[model samples]
Target: MDYEISLETLLQHLGEEEPFPYGSVTPPIVQTSLFTARTLRERNTQQGRNEFGYTYTRVDNPTVRLVEQKIAALEGTEDALCFGSGMAAIASAFLTFTESGAHVICVATAYTPTRMLLESLLVRYGVQVTFVSGECIEEFAEAILPNTRLIYLESPSSLYFRLQDLRAVSQLARAHGIITMCDNSWATPIFQNPHALGIDIVLHSASKFLGGHSDLLAGVVAGRKEHLEPVRRTRELLGGVLDPLAGWLLLRGLRTLSLRMERAHKSGLKVAEWLAAQPQAAKVHHPGLPTHPQHALAQAQMRGYSSLFSFETHPIQEEQAYAFADRLRLFRFGCSWGGYESLLLGWAQTESDANGKASWLFRIYVGLENPDDLIRDLQGAIDALTP
Candidate 1:
């Protein structure tokens, strides 16, 4: 089914085996490393279904396959594969498409490790990458080369949270016979469906929003069967498959994705707006806000926004920023977000504009807590910054 179907049905009931696997509400984790056949002839037959059947857990497992199906349904793709971590899925996709001398066009602000992968590992293999701002279609169009095999994008990308026009980029890639992949972790499928916009592949760091409870590390790659077939083979060879237990936990996480996304969306906007209006916040970088430069484009593409966003303080000292972060009781200082608890991360050194005015920047993740409580927690911290 397509994205038009209700997400509640897709997440709760889709891909569920009839009779509920011994009538249990949840599917059992088929944790065995091997699925054996009684006889050599049956073994050959089972092995023959290697790509589709479960002869081995590393190649495929029942629990992981179930998670893949639900993810495919959520992404509105024909098939999907789960990986041990987000980088595993990303690396597999890159390795699947790139040979020596292949070129890739990537957004400048993609996840840091991804950028590192492109700059370090991929370059070592003779593959070249061009990083673009991704603010306009022409930037991508101009960067394309004869050897360009892929265009990698991360809309509402890390930290600064810049956005790209997925439909535009997808069209550009298709016209050039190049594959397109997008990291959709920021605006989970509940808020944004990248595949529906014609992207060749949709990727997710399921460790974030999809896992919901911060208890699992999983990555997802979804696309047409033809596109994902080679990626699946690469996954098998690379040995980056998701564990069965993590698959089961991911299943648990998917059930509440819609509700959590809704909560995050509302609470996030409330907090972002409040921060934007504050005297200390020089700027807030949330697309949901009308003050955002690309608010119209964001509204055109995404149905709703998620909870992670960043803001800049009005030229605060590094120690002052640290003091503010330390003062907050409710917001935990951590790198990753998208779970039940609120998180904050500040750059200790202030960034300077071209004119050399320094300003401290910070990212906030509004969790499943009451927005008012989180706002109060933030207010207490900002109040601490006062003389």
Candidate 2:
């Protein structure tokens, strides 16, 4: 089927094809490590071409290919590669384009592991990295060195939810013969299409949203086939290929992605609004809110918002933050989000230079629950803090 269909229709129809043997509704999991070729001539022919006749699971599997195709289609890219985890995908993508002495310009508030990959490991190999606040387009332009080979961005950045002008940054990079990559996990393909905004490559922690159920860990990098070929080779060499079972689980998650995102989007905005009105919340950091610093840019670039966001708490002690989290009944105290259950996590500022109003930061992920119930639960948690 052509991928020009609506997203809702595309999700259901993209991965559907005639199942072999018995013609099942869903594709059968091709779970073998290796496949046998009928003849030497056939095997030689398959090896010579870039066709989909699989010889080994590490290189490619039918089940995994199906998920990759669906994600590529969703991202409006020519191809995609899947990985065992988000970091693996990210690492492979970076290794594909970067080399010794090459420099990278990365957003200041990117995913923690990604920053570490550049600072800790890549630096040892002589790859220089410059971290800049991508909120200003000029910061990226100024950060570019003669050796700069790539620009890494994460809009609505990790904890602060700060946005970058993707088009502006991408343009600046392309003019300088540099590649651009973005971690689009926060706003899944449902809400944002970075490639459409001129990013060279788009990435996702499929475990968060594409998996949707927290039952699987997978990652994806989607872009033109030329850009992904090296990343795919890096994945094969690194041996971080996603298993077939995880691929199947991801397919199940993608089937209902649109539905789940819609509910989460509405509930997230409602909760963000409620948090803003509360006395305990010093600042709310959701792009959907009018009070957000980049609300105009977000509306211009994104179709909708995701469920994950953070808020600064009014001057509260470390113990008070713990007590508030403990009092919550419905929201689970967890690290990850984009699952069926809501989660709340708190971070306390130990440094004296911390913003006085931002002594504690609370990150919230609204789930499939009713917004009113979640709000009441939060209100009770806050009330408990005072008592």
Candidate 3:
């Protein structure tokens, strides 16, 4: 029988309907630490699956496994591993693949904690990293060495929002026999499939789009079994397994992912377009924008854009950014986005000088609000900022 299902069908199957044959309509959270086997042989088999043989929730949980299977279906991968948080998933994937003295190339603006892992923790253990702008395919190619084991990327990077040419980067990584990993949180599988573009591993902070409500903290990595095994081992060993309740919440979030993403795509474009009209807005960066440097590439690879995007303004200072942010009533000033409520974050203090010239800018995570109301809020906030 053919296994392929349309995206909508996949969403319903993978997100809502658990493969578990339990009689309950809602999946009963498998909140047990141990499963009782009826016989010694059965116990032996199950034990082998667990600690000395399957005895703990840390190693495996039916609830978490269901979430992994669903994400795997959405991401078009062979298998997946789940983590307690986004950084935990990232750490498991890298720590499993990389050893002391392994050389890696990465886009400069990957998630800050991811960068910290490479530069701080991994470096102490002998890993060497080269941060490249990833402006051209050749940039990564030039950075690779004989010892380079992996190429890391975060397209439409978090704060900076730089778009990497995934096809070009994946081709380069494959040519050199190096594995490719990308943070796919921004676009989610509903908007873009990194696997279809030839990426080897796709990572997500399911806390963001996959969890959808900003309620649960979770992460997932999807790829071939070879890559997933190491991640699973690392997660199991490191005790980063996601809880059953969080897994259930993420499953609930995944149900409306298609609808939420579609609305985000349209609303995000409208917001980006409207932001382009503001006088204080120096430049707006979004893949959906015709003026974005990588618009063509984004359009080619992504099915649609999401509400998360960044905008840089002329005022120059974290204070100005925060001032504008504080004035907004609808857009809450905080981190951790992808909810019914919109969020705004000011530039990191490291982004500015003592003299107050803003080196970086604010990012916006638009929510399911009326576009006209959002614009009016932005208009009032911009007007509030004074010299």
Candidate 4:
């Protein structure tokens, strides 16, 4: 059965072919802290081999390796590593390339915790980080230092859904001998293939769309085998290996990812378009919308859109923002999204926004719910903003 298959087929069957003692369709979780090596010589031989012949769970786990392979295949990379959490994967990726006094340039609109990791932790450890508007390739160029080791980006960025020119930035980084990493969580592997655009590493918060249930927390980094070895070593040292149960759950989620993402793509665009027509919404920040400033870039770069997007309301007081969020009945007021349930989150301003005023900015995640239902929920909530 050696044949190329579509991603849709790959997702369903890529990692499920392990030979179990019984004829179970799904791979059984080797839920143990350590595996028996059979003999010292065998143990040494297994340790010497690069394949995931598990000596310790912290080093590798069969369940985790299966998901890692699935993710790597999905990302069109040579190898991939899974971590206990998204931040763990992110930290390991950064720490692998950066030493004390190393310089890095990060996109300004990256995830809040990612910025914190760079500004709060990495800075304290003597790493220099410059936050730049990735929307402008020139900012990345101007911020690069002789010692710049990494350029971190999150396209259709965390808050505003702003996009960076991945190919352009990657080419620029290549010329400078700098490695480039991008958080592909927003678009997921389904939509954007950063590696195809020449990115060095592609990272994902598997807890989002990959898990699709919000029940597990995991992260993945996919790239060439050589580039991932250092991150694997760092993950070992940091003890951030995802548990077998979580790995299995993530694999289960992957089975339906194509379906979920397709539904989200349609519903997200429908909702974003409907929101734009509403008087309350000053602007919609979805890349799928023709009105988005970087719509053309997104169209060229991404194969599809994700469920997540943001919208700005006509200037409203802070209380009104809270009231609108509270009024939402169908949309859950929660933090993370990409699950079966719709979510709504309101923020005064993102870290990149300098104004820091009390304005209504709502980030929406359209889920598997019917688009009309989500729209009605949003419309009702917006209606609350009136007087």
Candidate 5:
């Protein structure tokens, strides 16, 4: 729970010794479909035993449980469950919390897939949802209805890096007896803990920061045991359990999480500051920078910043924006981030705004690259944009 001492130390050693065999430094993969008990009675009662009483890998496994425990500790939760993908975890949470005719309030800028899930899928199930700007707690308050069952948040949202007042929204949800869930992939546990800020559940696309490398796909949900029991049941019934190898990779990723995050935080701020100074960059949307609208709120809630952030460029043609991205040497054109390599994604509004100008927006993920070198790469791209 204590971010400084306990969490940092837990990442290094938590659950490693007990799950591993013969004092193996790294935990074993536990790569098997089933585990047999010595007696019929034991096999019959495995479900009643503790969480580690693994009857099948789909239900539980030592390797996956180890990763779950580490994430639970890192997020300061009573327990956690791992899933095959981020959307699987999100779907399980949404499925477990709401029933037909229930109403939900979600941030407008949550992950695109999550929005699609709510808009495209859940609506078919008779669930109603309202999307709010999330910058103002009043928007969530005003959107709440008598049938509202949940409120979803994504602070420092993926594209704009906009932040919501977690504590404020949590308090509002508690007053309404509504459950609160947060997508914390943007600010990994190393930077922010939504549960500690009063959120009921914390979700992550472990494929990003948690995996550290782009080699694995996994998701995690962490909260109190009671709140997570239903989710765990949903996970089991849905069959979205993480595979053994990905769990092993996540275990390896956890070891260096702290070091990687520290580098990302510093480098991200440096690059954002430089971008803010550029004439072509209309605005930089990094919470770590004081220029950010919610910088003070971010400081009060999060101990650190993530590498991913977005910025708006002075009005430019869509082709020119693409040209700038194509010119970058260090930052790759990719959809995912929080890995070893920097990435760039650019888009422009198809229709002009009230001012009859369409500004291009770009999301940048500052990786483990040297700040100076990345900056030069960006400068080169900017210089070549007009040509």
Candidate 6:
């Protein structure tokens, strides 16, 4: 048996096994709040254990634990912990590691909610943070405070698609005894392995790729057993642990992740290349593009690309962006991606309009569709946008 089996193979069998003789290939969802032990002594004995112990759903559940174990193995991590949402996993990792006075260095173009959590909530609690471009390793080194306790990264960053040097940053963090974490949702394990680059913690918005459908809201954090144990304990204490049904769904979604991701990569590149060649397009950002500043780094680190990417166009006005978006028939307007449906999000009202944080740029998630048809659709949309 090869430990390094194909992702398709791993997806099929990762967490679907049953413990009993029911002969059910699919793992049953243990939907109860609590479990009963055969005896008090037996319960006490089981409580002393780790994976096999399952006293409560919030503390741990058999179904959810199986998902954790499966993801841990897939990520080449010692253990994993699931959460109600991606933010829960992210916030818990911070809370578990950093105290009130600890410092963190983060990317400026991070996920908006994560930025809010760091700036508003964490700063209010005495956890100071520094934001940087995250393009060069030296930026991270320059931002490090004496009390810096953690470093967070999101490669091919949210809006700008800025790539970070994970190995360099991780090495710097390790030298200073600071914990390193990256949101791995964008790359997934199929594309990049942050752990292999010496990152201590890896986070995911399972609601996107891991779930492989737009229906579920879930998250997972993977890392060494020592680092993740505290996060697991904190999750148990905070009551943000994943439920059994979501775990089962996630397990089911991952069954076709490898296949879905391959198609996504192919379609993504085709779309990006098409966009790059368009006269109306101002810029297209994707790691798969050779024109991307960090394309070489991405090639060195990742196995494949995903469909989620962004682009810009010469709009007559902000309204043109929305007009272009509305003209498209195949791409539905949606907030999140990694599902089977092609989606697009139009730019929001500008910061000048409402003193908002900032306006959104055009973002697209290329679903499994014909590349030529999608290109045709995009061309018509762009044509309609010009005044």
lDDT: which candidate is best?
A: 1
Screening candidate 1 with a backbone cut-off below 3 angstroms (N, C-alpha, C), the clashing residue pairs are none
Listed in order, each prediction's TM-score against the native is 0.95, 0.95, 0.92, 0.94, 0.95, 0.93
Q: What are the per-residue Cα lDDT tens digits for candidate 5 across 1-387?
A: 445566777678776545457767887789998887777776667653333576788788888998999999999899999999899999999999999999999999999999999999999999999999999988988999999999999988979889999999999999999999999998899999999999999999999999989898999999999999999889889999999999999989989999999999999999999998888888889999998999999999998998898888776666677778878889888999878999988878446666555687889999998999999999888853431
In model 5, which runs have C-alpha deviations exceeding 4 angstroms?
1-5, 45-52, 350-357, 385-387
- Cα deviation at 23, candidate 2, in Å, is 2.5
Which stretches of model 3 miss by more than 4 angstroms? Answer: 1-4, 15-22, 45-54, 316-322, 348-360, 385-387
User: Stretches of candidate 2 above 4 Å error?
Assistant: 1-4, 48-52, 350-358, 384-387
Estimate every model's Cα lDDT from 0 to 1: 0.90, 0.88, 0.85, 0.89, 0.89, 0.84
Indicate whether candidate 5 or candidate 6 has the larger TM-score.
5
Position 303, candidate 4: lDDT: 94
Which 10 consecutive residues of model 6 have the lowest summed lDDT? 349-358
10 residues in a row with least lDDT, candidate 5: 43-52
Q: How far does residue 255 in candidate 5 sit from its true spot (Å)?
A: 0.6
Lowest summed-lDDT stretch of 10 residues in model 3?
46-55
lDDT of 6 by residue, 149-171 (tens): 99999986786677888999999
Better model by TM-score: candidate 4 vs candidate 6: 4
TM-score: model 4 vs. ground truth: 0.94
Candidate 4 RMSD to the real structure: 2.8
Measured on C-alpha atoms, candidate 6 has an lDDT of 0.84
lDDT of 6 at 316: 45
How many angstroms is residue 310 displaced in model 2 relative to the true structure, after the best TM-score fit? 0.8
